[model samples]
Target: MPSVNPPRGMRDLLPADKARRERVLATIRERYRAHGFDEIETPVMEDYVRLHAGIGGDNEKLSFSVLKRGLDAEAIAAAADDPARLADLGLRYDLTVPLARFYASHRAELPTVFRSIQIAPVWRAERPQKGRYRQFVQCDIDIIGDPSARAEAELLAATLDAVDALGLEGAVVRINDRRLLDWMLGHFGFSADERPGVLITIDKLDKIGVDGVVAELRERGVTPTAVDAFDAFLHRPQTLELRAFGEGSIRKALPEDAPDDVVADLVALGDAVGRARGIPAPYFTLPVQFDPFLVRGMGYYTGTIFELAHPSVDYSLGGGGRYDGMIGRFLGQDVPAVGFSIGFERIVDLLDAEADAAAEAIVLVHDRDLPPADLVSLKAALVAQGTRVRLEQRTKNLKALLERAAADGYTSFATVTAGQTAADLEVKPLS
Candidate 1:
């Protein structure tokens, strides 16, 4: 027999779960709209070549490709040496790629600086585990064609507000700059060719402490001199303080020789976000920190990088960064782009599902002997008055049926007689 369950890593949300998700999505949409970000959508599939493009970083390997239509056994066998040739398109692994294509296609119709909100499902082929799935939704907000720190500021402010609207408390954003990472690696003598691998190892700093990182770098056979320098810097003794984002704190977190320009840019971003949020001191208002080693895993990230953190979870809630060079690959002209994505599948589990109090929801328990016409009339009358009414035939397990109705979000239930009109019905709260 075929399995009586949804495909692995996919799910079928029942009515109650679906309704709760919709409520959360609605809240997100309203908050983003209020920030002047327009909602947009793109096709779930894109050309296989586009998915394979170097800009996707490691996510390209996980994309689910679709075989070319009408390909027979012989044709498929011929392409065995080059499997990518067998597929013409693939599911999008993230919204950023599709948004880049969309912007390139509709540049003339959009504003010079476009703020877009994309809330949709993206697919990846993966060995799913707790809180991770092969198919899940991503909530992204991106700004295109703006090259100033203000773009980053607006994104940070809007994202924090949306998280607040969802009632996910104590969320903080950890900010960094890709340029700073490169500079730091270079400062420590890591060659240009070795920076990527070195950054990957440093990204594990949170997972593995300083000693583990140094040991791993040595095992990877990186330059002995460079590894020694980096290891020494890591072991340097210093007081760790819980400071917010600012020039002083940022400088303290980095080497004394860290470039002044990048530090200035990050400070300006922090200040702008603070003012936008109407906090007297920007860093004090929100929990933005400067982590010189925060290497976000995307190769296309050109400058600023950030990850969303919460005290309740060991993993990030979501993250994104500046991919200024990505849109240029499609449009043939440089357009600065940056985005932040909320891990919907992860954060949704963190919220407490609360019944919507404003809805007038009811269940009608009608006798089996009642005429169908009478039941229909009663339901239509209640519905016309803007009440959500569900008709349930009275059952021998009447108590069980009412209990189920209450759990399904019905506020009250009423017994309907054949002759009773909507006004004659008496409602009792479900308990």
Candidate 2:
């Protein structure tokens, strides 16, 4: 017999687990909607050509392509050298790509500055491991057609609020700008042609440390003078703090000659976010931090990038950034955009079991002799009273049945006899 298990990287949630996950998702939905983001959805598949578009960065390589139907042996053999030719569509690896396509498809109907909420599963052909999967849900919010720092600020504020609503406080957002990264590389004598490869190496700073990055750059035969200069800077002793977001803090965290305009924009971002959270200016106490080396891996990020961090976990809880140029690839015109995605699987893993349902929820444990229609009627009466009711036939293991009901989120239970009416039922809270 075939093994009874979900696919290698997929999962099967039991009733209790599903209920718990739904509760968390409900909270996230309510919070995002409260912040004025309207939920939207797109198909799970997109054209293979679109999925392979250069904007996806490394994620495009991991997309699960769907093979075209009705391919003959000859056709498959002809395309063996270029496997991608065998497929015409692929599952989306992230919400942002689908959102870009969505905006391009429905631009005229949306607001000039559209804020969208996308809570849906995305698939990638990832090697599954702890906290990583081939399929997972992403909670994403994006603002389209807004070029100002306010766009980025709104994204940060809303995302932080959602995280707070989920009862995961003390999460800090680390901010950076791709433009600053580019300029810093140039200032360190790296050419535009060499910057992409160098950024890939620099992105490994946290994983490999300063020496590892230097060693890799050297091995790659990057500019010798630039490597030495960067190495000296990396080894330079400097006091760094996890300070509140502010102009002084931002500049202090960067190299001495960091661009003034970018610094000013970042300061404005902090201020705007602060204002949104009702924190007055000149007093900076938001949970935002500036990390000059915070490079989000996606190549589509055109400006500000951020990652959600907590002191409790070495890995990021979530991240996103300004991808002002992505939509233009589909729409034929530039649309300023920024978004944040909460890593739902990671967040869910950190959450405690959901509390039992309130008193309005109850299970009707009917005697075996009770008619099915009568049992359903008893449940219907309770349900009509705005209660959640489930009818279960009395089992030999009474204790186990009640325990299962409680675990499934029922707060109370009532014993039902052959001719008992709704009023005759005595509901008692589950222990």
Candidate 3:
């Protein structure tokens, strides 16, 4: 027999998986819609150039390329040697890049400030682990062509709302500004050219601790003084008490002086949005510490960037940021865009573990009198009514069927009797 298992790093999404994923997706879509974001989609496979041009940091290495046959052998050999030419098309790594390309290509059709939601699968050649898969769905919402910091505020609010809709407790939205990180780096004597590598290492601070970051930076050729300066800068009073500083404190730290004004604007924006939307003030919290060390590895992010992490989970649940220059790279005009993506598989894993405690078993009725067409109709109707119904083949006896359903943890059974024209459904509570 041929190999029966799925390829490594991928698995089949059975019916139960579909149910949980759909529930999460529906909740996200409804929440985003209520926040004034329209629904949109982009192609699954895009030209390699369009996808690669603006991809942030390490993602370029993870893309899964699709190559066409019948090309010259020498050309094929060369393409294989050079990643840039290996394939003309690739599975999309994330939704934001496609949205950027969409805005640039259809600038006239979209509004000045377009708000949209996209739920789709993205591919990466990653080593799979718990809650991490090579093929997974990303739910994204973005606002394009809006340069105001209010756009960032709105995106953050929508994110908070969407996760709350997911019913996850103790979720934190960690926010940081890319410009702040840049400023901090410049202030500490690291040149602009050296920021990316150092920042990427620092961004891993949450995963690995301060020592891990320092060690990684040293390995990357950063001098001891620079590392010490970076560490000390991260622990400054202004950085530590970010939530307490209103505007005046921000001005004192940087020569630019405008950061305080932006922080003030963000504070006001958060308040105005809460009042207008009738959202409770407690849903958004400004923790005291703001790390200027947080530089999300994405190259396109230019403004506010955030990560939504569950306190119980060691990994990030979702993350996104503003990319003002991304669309301009393709269309010759600057378009501001911001978005967030929720990992569908991670959410499902969390929900399934919870749902198992309230396990319910579904019983399928298989009788000789029920025709195939009728059985199909009955199964569809029961499913539409929010029931999980299993199908029974005619060969199975009631005792055997019941035994199987019991093993599957189904507590209820529905079936047609010998003389019955319509089906009879029964709920049986299991001990």
Per-prediction TM-score to the true structure, in the order listed: 0.96, 0.95, 0.83
Error of 1 at 281 (Å): 1.7
Error of 2 at 357 (Å): 5.4
Model 3 Cα shift for residue 214 (angstroms) = 3.0
How does model 1 score by TM-score? 0.96
Q: What TM-score does model 3 achieve against the real structure? A: 0.83
Task: Tell me how far candidate 3 lies from the true structure as C-alpha RMSD in angstroms.
Answer: 4.1
Best by lDDT: 1
In model 2, where do residues sit more than 4 Å from their true spots?
240-242, 280-284, 354-359
**lDDT of candidate model 2 versus the reference:** 0.88
- Using TM-score, give the best candidate's number: 1
For model 3, the stretches where C-alpha displacement exceeds 4 angstroms are 72-74, 223-225, 234-258, 269-291, 352-364, 369-411, 421-431
Quantify how close model 1 is to the true structure by its C-alpha RMSD in Å.
1.6
**TM-score winner between candidates 1 and 2:** 1
Q: After superposition, how far is residue 378 of candidate 1 from its true place, in Å?
A: 2.5
lDDT values, one for every candidate: 0.90, 0.88, 0.71
Per-residue lDDT for 393 in model 3? 62
Better of 1 and 3 by lDDT: 1
